[model samples]
Target: MRTQFGSPIDYFLELGADTIHMNELLGKPLHMKYVGQQCLNCGKDRKIYRMGHCYNCFYELPQTADWVIRPELSKAHLDIEDRDLAYEKDVQLQPHIVYLALSSDVKVGVTRKTQVPTRWIDQGANSALEIVEAPNRYLAGIAEVALKQFVADKTNWRQMLKNEVAQEDLFEFRAKLSQHIPEEVRPYFLSEKSDKWDLDFPVQKYPAKIKSLNLTKTPEFSEKLAGIKGQYLIFEDDTVFNVRGNEGTVVEIFIS
Candidate 1:
């Protein structure tokens, strides 16, 4: 699923040669048949290990390095190798941001400067604000580690999908939280008034109870498209399928 920011986020799902405009499908009946599975990384017929990677690719690819989840372990600055030093340096040595995002709750996180709104959107955050910027991922990770003592570092996915969010004054929150940042990383905190972003998703209704779909278990299903939020497709029957979770699954989509 590819997303673009808009009045409501615009979603596109590319099926072979076709790019389906998902926003236009709301309230319409759609059928999907899970044909088979393939590895997203190697493009081979294999069971996806994690997020579309084959088992071999999962352990071999630098993108799946341990540092990806634990940014604090990023050693690119020290020229240490996790998978590939060159690849790690190219990614981990780049500029990164420490931010607070409002999804189910306010959470502290770090991401590459370029990922920006994309990262926030992926987490289904309704709003976000950058609190600090660092020259590299390592520094941003350190700042995130420090801030985690005061603020949660993880998003409650279930709560986020339920749209359970509380309003917060990010400016004031950042001010209070900034005081907790370790002295070593405090210098990287942004003093300027940071821009706050509010995001809206294209959805006719939000599910009160989420019913997750597994393509591997149910090969074929049809339902009315109710909404799209984050990477999940909400159906009128209250079934929510995560397109990202089924990244390597091959499916045929039909709409009428």
Candidate 2:
């Protein structure tokens, strides 16, 4: 006997279950022979048409806006290693954050650590206009701000996550994404931007400085060392050093 989607074989494998018997159907071990499709995000060979999504691609997709509200439940399907894998597939480890902002009927987000769905689930995101998972934190932040600025009043953001919006509404939101992203970073998303030029990225530089200095034994230095109990470090690197007390006074310094 066949159900609406046919036999239960595929669902069993997708869930990684050894034996799956639909309670509504006659009990028997099942297997699914599914047709494949090209993955939209990674272009991987997949049986997405019948599977709904390839497991690899599904795990790689950015978490929805609703993740922040129910992180544990939302991430329940994730195994420990899978979380790390997601990050490896879609993002890199760096100082970055992603936000799923709702503007009327749409939501938009970006993150440096977008692989961690729990981050958004903890942020109370209701839904998103677009989830921009990128390598750099700055780009993600700017993308979110762009969407917020352009689609502020046109869409109902809440309905988008709840599945209340129709397909036409999503298409409209998709079209409007161009008005948000800057031309240079537009390649990160599905749509293109009008202002196509290389953005002048701010350069960060390190300073050469001393973190600590150790001196031969002295009275004041000995007293201060006795009372201190924590991490201390001296860096001759590019970091600025803030010295307190008398500069001429000899003191001991410890660096980690």
Candidate 3:
């Protein structure tokens, strides 16, 4: 049959068409039906496509998986911060994560808004994702820890710190973070002379064995996140990406 373009040639020869259409040249192009399927998580009947996941399931998956592995494009969110950190300026800012992928391996890191990409690139991470949209610095740090657990690579945690700390604040938290790591990984993290601020919680080393944490297995207690049903994703480190929408946090939500 003649195509919509009216080329008068076989439609099957096109890039994505089937040869069967050529066999019956006079027949109309086949019309497929759309069947709704139940959500994998909540068993709610819904439409599913591509890999048994509905549209809602798709976006919930990490958009940064590739972006984190390459950080240059991701640094637009922090151009202003870069200037501040380089000038040794004192700025009280919320923390964010520099999600990294080193030749396909995952790394999770924390930084003040300005120093994140600079810090990641210095740590041998050629690619990175900056989670600049988090609620606060502490929660951003928590997201970093979660991402590290998800990626499940301490080597990614090889170099990370809560920057913008004063000498007294550094003195207070250094003893805590130092207890967990060797002296080698501590130097790059020392706060600048004019910097002031600190982590409320000491950087806790995530257990190596628990790298397989899956959000699918964790029960959902929050009502807001319930709409995010039947949608699950496994990050580079195998941690299941859970849907936890904090106040003012923008989650690219999915519903199936």
Candidate 4:
């Protein structure tokens, strides 16, 4: 699943040798048939261990390094290597931001500076604001860890999908949270004008109840496309399928 931030985020489902324009298919019938799983890393027909990777690739690839989830473990600044020194430095040594976003609720998170809006979109954030900017991922992670004690670090996906978010004053929230920053990373806190980005989704209707689709359980399904939000494709019957969650699943799709 590829996403572009627009008035309502634009989504594209990338199939082999083809791309399906999802927004255009809303309100129409779509048929999808799951064929098999293809390891995104090794490109072999194998069971997906995590994020489309086979077990071997999941354990071997530098992309799946432990530091990915625990940014505090980042050692690129110290010239230390986890899996690959070059790759670690290229990613962890770059600028990163600590942010507050409103999804189901306001939550704290961190991401590379360049991934600003993209990260928020993937998390289905209705709005977001940057609170701090760090020279590297380690400092950003430190900020996030400190803020976690005061605010939640995780988004409630169920509430997010229900579009049941409450309004929050991010500007005020940032000011209060800034005081809690660790002394080591306090200098990196951003004081610029915080801009709140309000995002919309291309959905004719939001489901009152969400029924998730599992490709592994049911190999084929067809339904009328109702909408698209985040990485999910909404069906008329309130059933939603997460394209990114089933990344390595090989499927044939027909939209009409």
Candidate 3 minimal-lDDT segment of 10 residues: 221-230
The lDDT, on a scale of 0 to 1, for candidate 4 is 0.88
Runs off by more than 4 Å, candidate 3:
1-92, 156-256
Q: Candidate 1: worst 10 consecutive residues by lDDT?
A: 185-194
Q: After superposing candidate 4, which stretches have Cα over 4 Å from the reference? A: none
What digit string (tens of lDDT, one per residue) describes model 2 on residues 27-119?
A: 222222222345444556654432234566555545422332222122322333333446433332343433333322444544445334332
- Tell me which of candidates 2 and 4 scores higher on lDDT: 4
For model 3, what is the alpha-carbon lDDT of residue 205? 24
lDDT of 3 at 212: 28
Q: Write the per-residue lDDT of candidate 4 for residues 152-231, one digit (tens) a residue.
A: 99988777877889788888888889789999898888767557788888888788899999988988899999988778
* Alpha-carbon TM-score of each model against the true structure: 0.96, 0.28, 0.24, 0.97
**How close to the true structure is residue 169 of candidate 1, measured as C-alpha lDDT?**
81
Candidate 2, position 119, lDDT: 25
Give candidate 2 misplaced runs (Cα > 4 Å).
1-104, 113-116, 123-131, 152-168, 192-256
**Cα RMSD, each candidate:** 1.3, 25.3, 21.5, 1.1
Judged by whole-model lDDT over C-alpha atoms, candidate 1 comes out at: 0.88
Q: Candidate 1's residue-wise lDDT over 1-256, tens digit each? A: 8889988999999877889999999999999999998887899999888978899999999999888988889998998899999999999998899999998889999999999888888888999999888888888988888889988988887777778887788888899997788787878888675689899988898888888988878889999999888788999988999988888889999898
lDDT of 2 at 146: 62
Off by over 4 Å in 1: none
